[model samples]
Target: MSIQNFLSNLDPRLQRMVLKNEQLEEEGLHTEAQKENLIPVIAKVTNIGKFQKITGVQKVTEITTAPDRSGQIVTAHIAANALPTVNKSPVVIQLQGAQPVKPLLKDTAREINLPSPQESSGNGGEGVIVGIVDHGCDFTYSSFRNTDGSTRLLALGIQEMMNDRTTSFQVYNSQQINKALGKPDPYKELQYPVDKYTHGTHVTDIAAGNGRNNKASGVATKADIIFVEPAYWDIPRGNLGNFGDSINFIEAVKFIFDQAGNRPCVVNISLGTNGGPHDGTTLVEQAFDGFVTDKPGRAIVIAASNSYADNIHTSGVVAQNGHIDLHWSIPTNDFTLNEVEIWYEGSDTFQIEVIDPQETTVCRVGLGELYHDGQIFASQEKSALNGDNVAMILCDVDREDMSTGKWTIRIHGSNVNNGKFHAWIERDNHTIGIQSIFAASRDNNYTIGSVSCGHKSIVVGSYDAKNLNTPISYFSSAGPTRDGRHKPEISAPGHGVLAAASLTGNGVTGMSGTSMAAPTVAGVVALILSEAKALGVNLDIDQIRTILERTARHNPPSQQGWDSRYGHGRVDAHAAVAAVRAMAEGRQPLPSAVTQEEKEALVRR
Candidate 1:
């Protein structure tokens, strides 16, 4: 694949950025200030030949080449003047930085009735791998060690931010990890810090960590683990910049899959973004879907996100020639600029007008137009908001305009007959003190997020183990995705679930959210794969999903079939393992194939 093909296929924001960098380079804008604005991107190619071609054209650096010759990973400093020429060549996939996906976590493992290590010893997930792509991990944690006190970690990949304004990837195998653990400072010995954020260790413990002192045992207790910590850069004002981007995530996934070799593997991703179209059309989503499709013994599980109760999403239908009004609540004391993205069917055209809380028209911009008013500027563009064909509104709020009231946005439909539009209030890990509300009759669905909305991935929602009567967590993101696909295929114990704490002496800790719920399912998948591998069978993703749904325990208020809130219901690991065993014995039929219509529908967005 050629770099030009990859650049052309990138998300529009990234495509535009790369093209702008090429333009600047052509104009001799090579000064430090000019180069500072250039976008850094990672490109994954099919082979070393394509990697060489890309590096020859751009200032590219190799991240890693797959040991199996499956692909090559490289990063490039895309300048404004060095855009590659497009030619007839193979299409190469590329991705850029997306909104950060955060950690969701823990509890009473007893709530889900996790089997004892002795009980599951016959199929103790020995031949399977549990891959965790998250923050840093605590390799020295007892939970990650074997009964002999040897490390159970198979490999580790650390994505580091270099001082040269580029990113570097360092991978360590079992020997290296064990050597580092033998040192006085294991993290320093490995030249990487411990799980300081603590998110990765907690998540990893929930999925495959062995019990420490007979406490906090995770699913797939015997499964080997592989982990990655994506690159992160801390910026000013308490914001984390350049962390959890799509590029690093893709690379991490590739690394895990390649290293798993012939072993059955399941990867758990508790991170997600609410930025892209709820339909999985982004390059990252497409790449993942392709990787998992038709590939038996491989799976990827993701968090359904914690956006359901955030009051940040508003959706409504626009009648032909009629208008709808949305109220955006801006906090009074915050002076930071905010952004809100509105998405509608590409075929439909609409107009948006913003009125200040003081009842003054501040600005109104239609599709592809930029509205500027000194410090307060607004803009709308087509296919520029996170690579989706939607209208985006960027608002730079002056401190004087932060009146802490409902700012009115009136949207008039031009050709909309039955088309619907969704507006999302952008959220960061830190508090920005802004909220959004729709008319009482409007706001209904809140079950959507980047990657979670993907068609093939298993998106897990959160439930409360402590309260069986109210098992569904209030924060769990529920979904009939934007494309009307029932998301969050299942729910799991996430609230107050106890797991290993990082950097502590055989410590146990508890956290809550869908992040915790996802790894639970990943661990169960490991168990299933382990059993299937023993039975000389390779389970497809669809088969694993069907087994889970069939064996899950339905919570109250949700029927036996799929429900938006609980998917097929709370995950039942014991029953799920039993079901896989039944399938192996030819007592049950395999899952039905995905219809061609269904396959096409996944990418329709």
Candidate 2:
């Protein structure tokens, strides 16, 4: 492959790193760049050995191999100088965006036939394992402890800082957690004071908290818990997409399953980024699909996303030999970087040009090319695996020279066989730092996050569980994937959900997001898995989706079946378990899809 072609295959971050390498060498900063540059990536390949050998890899770990044995997902680090070798040999399968690492839930458990810990054991999810991969976890929370004050977390993997330009993890088993709990200062002795952000702990509580001190209980309270603090956001205050990431979640999932060792395990990943094809075909989504389908009694649930009103998506049909101007605005005083990804048919090509807020063309990326000015960057590439094209506009607001305001993106159709194209603003947390968005012709559809698009993933959206209407959360993302496949198989309680607060000594806290909803479904899945295991019936991802689709309670009460706001509907934990029991007894058969009448008829009370 030519150097340019090889460069196009690398992710946007690594591509920039490669181009920057030569400049740094010229300035005698090669060593400094090496010290600060550790590029960790997840790639799918047919031959792992060849991929490692060609990439000059010092270490390689296998995350997952697809169920149909299509490819293997592996993590390999590339030095700044090794960029040229990235996809030249043993090609690295690409996802959608160039997400850099930055530092970056829950429900009632009683709906699933749980009385009280004293009255009943709540064995509905007993003998199952629940896995959590999120920003951080608080093992010291009483909700995560047994009645005797012993830790309920089976294993906790905390991502350590990058050392020698490589990511590492420090794992603690129940024994180690117990040892730390016995210390005079557990937080000081354990060396992890991540209570400031209780994201992981809250989500975990919604999945497996034991209802300590009469707090809000989770569905799978009796299930063992495995928590993973993702490496990218393990530090202090990082945006969701600014820090280099992923592959850590895959590593964490693999670790949890390894520890599970044939025990029915369900993983709840309450975090995701809006940077992928959203077609269940990206390498990351492929790996997630593999995780659940590769074995029976295994499942994964992810947030549908919370960007419904973010105005991050826009779509239009570019006329042949004509152009469409897409307006994008960068909020003022924004210090962080922002980007937009455009995807269309691979057969058609478009001329990409970006006009700044000042109405001056900053950069024009040609067909099958990459362009980079000091403040702006652009690129277009055709996927060799999936026959889809992806183009991107990235603005570096952190640069002093970069301007912030309304910018116009001009996409001129060249070969207009299929002019329909969709563009998305990559995930930005938009805390105090201003976030950029599409200013005009914005779209709300196809807002589901990256990995949640997987076919086998039971994606969960957020809803107002406390409201009488049980309304869909205003922030819950809408989706019918890029390929027109229904996503977020179900919705769940997320608005003002009462769950655990980290390091608060059994105190309860209320938070809301799709992150809270995912664990609700995961906890319910654990109940199904536990019952399945006891009945000597193993359930695969297909069966799980079917059971969920058939059991969810419709949101609008008369909306019939699936809608973008709520897939099948809000999750019904009790209905799902009953269906699982019926399936185990051979008294009920799983239906493939909602029938026409099912979509037309109002959901009767």
Best by TM-score: 2
Candidate 1 Cα errors over 4 Å, as ranges: 1-36, 41-77, 80-97, 105-108, 115-122, 163-165, 195-197, 233-244, 333-337, 371-388, 396-405, 431-444, 590-605
Residue 271 C-alpha lDDT in model 1? 81
Relative to the true structure, how large is the alpha-carbon lDDT of every model?
0.67, 0.74
Query: Candidate 2 — worst ten consecutive residues by lDDT sum?
Result: 234-243
> Which regions of candidate 2 fall more than 4 Å away from where they truly are?
1-6, 29-38, 90-122, 234-243, 399-402, 429-433, 555-557, 590-605
Candidate 2 lDDT over residue span 1-605, tens digit each: 11144466656655665655555566665453354454566677788877777645546788788655767877766665665566666445542223432221333453323333332222658889999888668888887888899998888888775554446878898999999999988877778877554788888888888778476677787888888887765322221124346666677778888888788999988877777677887666777787777778899888888889889899999988999999998887776667888889987889888898778876677556787654566778776547788887777677444568888999999888989998988776556746688998988999988777887888988888676777889999998899998887888888888888877777888888988888888988988887788777888888888888886665453576688878887776666665666666686364554443442231221
State the RMSD for candidate 1: 7.4
* lDDT string, candidate 1, 478-585, tens digits: 788777788888888887777777888478777888999899999988988887887766788888888777666654535657878788777766666655656666
lDDT of 1: 0.67
Worst 10 residues of 1 by lDDT: 234-243
Each candidate's TM vs. the true structure? 0.82, 0.91
How much is the lDDT of residue 2 in candidate 1?
Answer: 9
